[model samples]
Target: MNQDTPMLPSIEPATLEWREGQPVSARFGDVYFSRENGLEESRYVFLAHNRLPERFANLKAGDTFVVAETGFGTGLNFLATWQAFRDQAPSGARLHFVSVERYPLTSDDLRQALSLWPELESLADELCEQYPPLVVGNHRLVLASGDVRLTLYFGDALEALGELTFEADAWFLDGFAPACNPGLWNTSIIEQIRQHSRPGASLATFTAAGYIRRALADAGFAVQRVPGFGPKRDMIRGDLPPDGQNTGDGNGSILVVGAGIAGSLLARNLADRGRTVIVADRGEAPGTGASGNAQGALYAKLGVQFNDQTRLSLAALLHAQRYYPANTPRVWHGTGLLMMAGSEHERLRQQKFLQQNEYPDRILTPVSAEQARSLTGVPCPHGGLWFPGSGWLEPYRLCTTLLDHPNIRTEFGFRATRLLPCNNRWCLSGEGRQDLIADAVVIAAGHETRKLMPVLGEFRMKAIRGQVTSLPSGALTATPKAVVAGTRYLNPPMNGLAVTGATFDLHDSDPQERLSSHQENIAGLESMIPGLLSCDDLASSVSGRVSFRCTTHDYQPVVGALVNGDGRVLDGAWLFTGLGSKGLMWAPLLAEHLADCLTGQPAALPRSLARRVDPKRCLAEPVDTGVPVG
Candidate 1:
């Protein structure tokens, strides 16, 4: 898929009405919940039928349970389940709730609809705060201090469910009335659900249609009819009997090499999902590599012509914009970003990006020179593209914050030099000595990863050095209110300092800060904003940092299972390197994807985008697994 491919159309927001003070979907011509008492009806139909209260109470320490639902109308069921899990679940237990919605309600609609139930206000507000866009893909929201996880797939039910990689512990079959929305209850969707269900998994639905019962039974469920809530007399419930089918939730220990943003994010992802994670780094602390930069810009790097690289970058940027704020101000700043039209060629490219894609203004808007200056509080030479959700953050702060999770342990100065597999486990050794042993290992040491995995050389990875110059805020006439990027970037001031200038030197490994590169950065900055800074100010500036960034020829990160020269997958081994300069934007998304691959959870990206970053894509030879690399 390329830029010429049409953008995935967003799901139309549900048009809702009021029926006896309860919200009703006009499209389906059905009430969202029982008009008699929506809260009680939800409790009776979903929670009671699924035995959630008992399950929550029985969860042992370090256990994780997943509950999947078909329709996430107003997120009432999710909130109810979250509240129950919070009130009754074991202290260290985790809850993963996955839901699918074809037509999601707008934020305003959800707020208005949920207002009827003041009892669910807390959870509703949390959901609203992290609500995702209406795009056709997955949005994983980690809530309640990383204890409750919500994965919302917005698209057709069958297509969305078919892409998921995890097995559900319980299913909530609630997609309007089966008669009104038969597509969601079709045999194919049911079969997909069955295939993605863990053995002994139970399902509950407020409908007892004969065909539904027969279809579920035919798919290997022990179906039964139970009393329904409200006026309905009967509801359907089923259990996938054990019979050696259940794949119990057991996440093994994982050792992540490199404490940079990539490794930190991967550790957080694994630890949040109940896996014990050990992070090892060659340096004395985290973010000592490229991720140690004072400030890194976060935005989708697009080209005049869209390619697989641009698509993956866009997806990663979108997910990062939404997910990075789970820990705001302390780690990130949502001050917005601006890409200046510094050159005529880039101005034309920016115009093409806007004309080719009908992106939401909030995501990317073409701003006039005057508008850009007013919005950013800086003098601008030309109109540029503004990303309201994009911003910059200190990479080290964010990496450390992510590693603060209870399930994550950090081993600084423990450089992993070799990955040796023994007895179905991986032993990561550093300097000819075993440093850590784990069931799985991920090599994420940026450019240095090539030394640990020689096969990575086949992918043509390069280490490019970058230097960023920082100046005291007083050096500028006025501080920019947002990040301004073009040939260089002038980030919003933080702690009385503003940062700009990153000279991308290909094939350079020197970490020494250079005055020549600093001058080049200033030249680029002046080219972007004509009179923003004078040569005297740049000459006086002395603070800067130089770090090595890893990149691949295709400009895509290498993720997924690591394969040997013989075209065999190294079991329990993964590679997550080659992020290059976009580490800030790509780390969180790819880390989550790697976590999903390891834990057998739903992938957060589409197959097309996922394949573009597959570790096997750059193989010297592509093997025919007949599995399309998904």
Candidate 2:
């Protein structure tokens, strides 16, 4: 399918009319109260029927309840729930409200509708602030100082419910009346909801329709008719009979293949969450992937105009700057980085962006060659945009630090041959005779994921073999304080050696360990820093490593749930690969995102951005271009 075509189903808005102090509507042919009545109906039918105030008071400290809703119209239900939770629930208890909305109203409409609740102004304001970018998929909004979390699924109600990985303690069946919205009241939807309900999960809705009650009863819920909220005569309330059997909460174990930055960081985050994680790699040690380089620069290449890649890169850069640890051997020097101004057109674009976006002044500054030398401690013929927050990091050391987590187990020389999904777990076969069973698995093994999982189809990944040459620090006029970029990138001395030039070669995948590429790297370095070093000086300092870097056409790292044929993620099978060269900056944040999704916590990044990183996204949509090999 092309980009212009919709990948998923879409819905139309319901028709509305004002009736007897209630705004009524017909959604999917089902009658519903659009505004006033809908808001009040939710407050009484859903909240009151669940006995929320009493339940909230009884919750233990730090305990959280998952509340799933059939529909999220105008978000009145959510706002009301938040208000009640804040007022009645103990400070330590958290309220997680997950709602499915097909046709979400625009921000303006939501704001106007929310204005009717004068007493709920504070809670409404919090909701409006993190209302998300309105793009499809899951959007998590943190409210009440992060105590309450609202996860909005903007798509088909059934499809959205399927994507949810949480077991609800309560359910709000507040879609349009059963007759008006048969899709919401159908047996299939009820069965799916029941599948995600924990024992004793309570449910309530304003309609006591017989079909709805029957569907609920058939789906394991004990249903009953109750006094309706407001002027209505009746409503429906149900509960999942207590199992009295605790199916011990299973420990979610994940096997992350490849110990590069991506896998190591993934291990770190999982370990932090008290998960038993194993990082497997064929190499003798970690960072033996493309991350074996001595020093790698950190900065986003600002495009002429902000495209999707540029926006993603900018967000990734900022996220890295804020979260990536600074105290590690990865030296973070505030000495700034210089992106040499080449063409007149490019310089103008940079100038325009500087005017519009208020970037951190201490981080980015436009400078001339003279100013650049004064700040960088080295002379340069061309001036460029200086990014002070950007600096060099020892990639191997960062990878090691990330893998240093106590719970992370690293097994070397374990090359995975096949993955089989069996009985709610993944069995990974390799050098070991017994298959390794895990609740989850992340394939951070780069371009090799395709070979491992043929079912993934074709991914837009290129294994670009790169070789970097290191020049001795003594060859320079003065040890450069900052990293210099253009056709070639030169970093300041780390351990008396300056590293530069990773000549990207797509024709070769086998590790050749070629001298020609090292010579090309030296030549490129000389062009960047004129008269600083001779061929002999550069070649003498040429002592760096080489590895294949896997990248996608869009340059965004894949990081999320892996969809499988059985409507479940092949037991524990997952992929964290295709990071390519930007792994240094992208791994930490993306790892956290994957960890959050696995733990059922609110995602840290925007839903659109998260989908862009999802491994399955490219499976459905093909990427037609390759980013220029740097």
Candidate 3:
């Protein structure tokens, strides 16, 4: 969809009230949990009825059990299930809890509501800390040091489960009373649950309504009535028999041709999900390519209009902000970011962005010049966009940490020169290195990927050369506490140096840094923040880096599976390049999407957003620089 398409509305925070120290939903006129021992009620209804404890213990090594719920009113059920899974499941097993909520509780309200149960304090604390911004989409949280995963869909329950891609082993048929919220128990919702349920999947609910039982029974579940919790007498339970449908793809060995952000993250994600991942890169270490930026920005650069690219970037930036602290803490912080309006054109663009979209200020806000200066600890020429949840991080360190996983085998110096079919697997080999065969392969070698997979030429991605000038921290009079960007970016100091400039040159593949590029960067910096640096006279000790970045004509990354011109698979090959320059902010979410597409799990992005990064769009769409490229 283009800019003319209406933007997806933001989710409103749940209006809650307290009745006798128990939280009640103001909208539905229902209590979030039973006033009589909510935790016990949760365990008796969802955990016990679904037989989760026994099922958790029965899971094989490396097995991931999925539990889906129609509503996540207070997270009481999820916490109880998590506690049980941890106590009873084997160490090697993982648990994925998927739940939907149209109106999510505010973090403060959630903390206060959950404070009623001290037994679930620890798990509740983590859940509250990792809770997503109340946005109208899915948010994936990797908690318990990656052993437990949660995907919270903040939209209509039916639409969520319809787009969701996963096989649930157990279902928590939850929501308010059928009379209060019939949408959650409608035929469409039942059909989606049945469609996602595994053959032997079991379901339990606190209600035993006849229509609900009949709907589930018609959808292939063997319905039963069970004893309920609290004042309820009878509850519903069911087991779905298989429909003989083949779920595409299996957990298998995968070969990733690049150890850059996209490839490294994708490899590690697949590995964490129980796939054996072999990472092959030509460099002696991770991020030696374009991913080797010393300090990179982690903010979404939205455009003047809410187009597909801007929408995806916003979603990805939010996802990555959550991912870093969840998966790898202390690597980065939300010290925040400032995008200066250095030019009149940019000033108008930033103004238009604010006017066109009604995004929450918690994500981004238009700041005055004084506010920008106050936020960045520098002089600001013009009012710009301020992102409170954005910052910078070392890409090299990120790649290294991601590749240092047991499930991911890193071949640092393996330059994958060829990709062809061998036996039933894809063979990835280079000039002298040993051939590596895997059930699937991901080509993420930036521009060089086109050489390995000739069919990628149809995708029309380009290799652009970029340069970033670095100045020692000691060289600057005062450094911005946060990352600042205009025509060029000035990141907070890393390795005793602050970085700026990145001359975006098309078709130039020079590996050597040029003085002209450094001058251009310094000039841009001078124009953005006049007295921030004395860089014009400080070139004697200046150092910079040059790298070739893969970018599409439209500047969006190409992700997911690649099909040939005739709409056939290209021998199990996947493409994940064209990240342009926002790899740090874009990599995490896009990598998660590729992993989902590969493993047949729930999607990280909606279909329309995902299509913007599809190979077909990157190939077929004409370049329209009508708006600023985010």
Please give each candidate's TM-score: 0.93, 0.62, 0.93
Give stretches of model 3 more than 4 Å off: 1-9, 243-251, 304-308, 454-457, 539-541, 620-630
TM-score of candidate 2 against the unseen true structure: 0.62
Query: Model 1 TM-score?
Result: 0.93
CA shift of 614, model 3, Å? 2.5
Local accuracy of candidate 2 as per-residue lDDT tens digits, 1-630: 554433222223334443443334433543345343556677788888887877887776456767889888778888878878888887667787888887676565567667777887887776765564343555555466446777787778888766666778888888776666677777778888999888989999888888888889988889999898666788889998887974222347788878888888778866755578988887788888787787888777765444445545665665465444332534454456888764566577777766544343444678997988777676677678888767778878777887887788888887788877778777778876456677777888877766766265455666888888777888777778888877678888978888887888886976866778878887776666676673364564357677888877666677766654322345456678777777866776677678767666545555445566766555534343231221
lDDT, candidates in the order shown = 0.82, 0.71, 0.83
Write the residue-wise lDDT of candidate 1 on 446-480 in tens digits.
Answer: 99987887353365578998998887787777679
- Candidate 3's displacement at residue 382, Å, is 1.9
**Clash total of candidate 1:** 0
- Model 1 misplacement above 4 A: 1-9, 244-246, 302-311, 432-434, 454-457, 536-541, 625-630
Point out the higher-scoring one by TM-score: 1 or 2. 1
Instruction: Locate the minimum summed-lDDT window of 10 residues in model 3.
Output: 621-630
180-291 per-residue lDDT for model 3 (tens digits): 9887888888888988888888999989999999999999999999888879999998997766765434678998999998998898888887789999999999999998
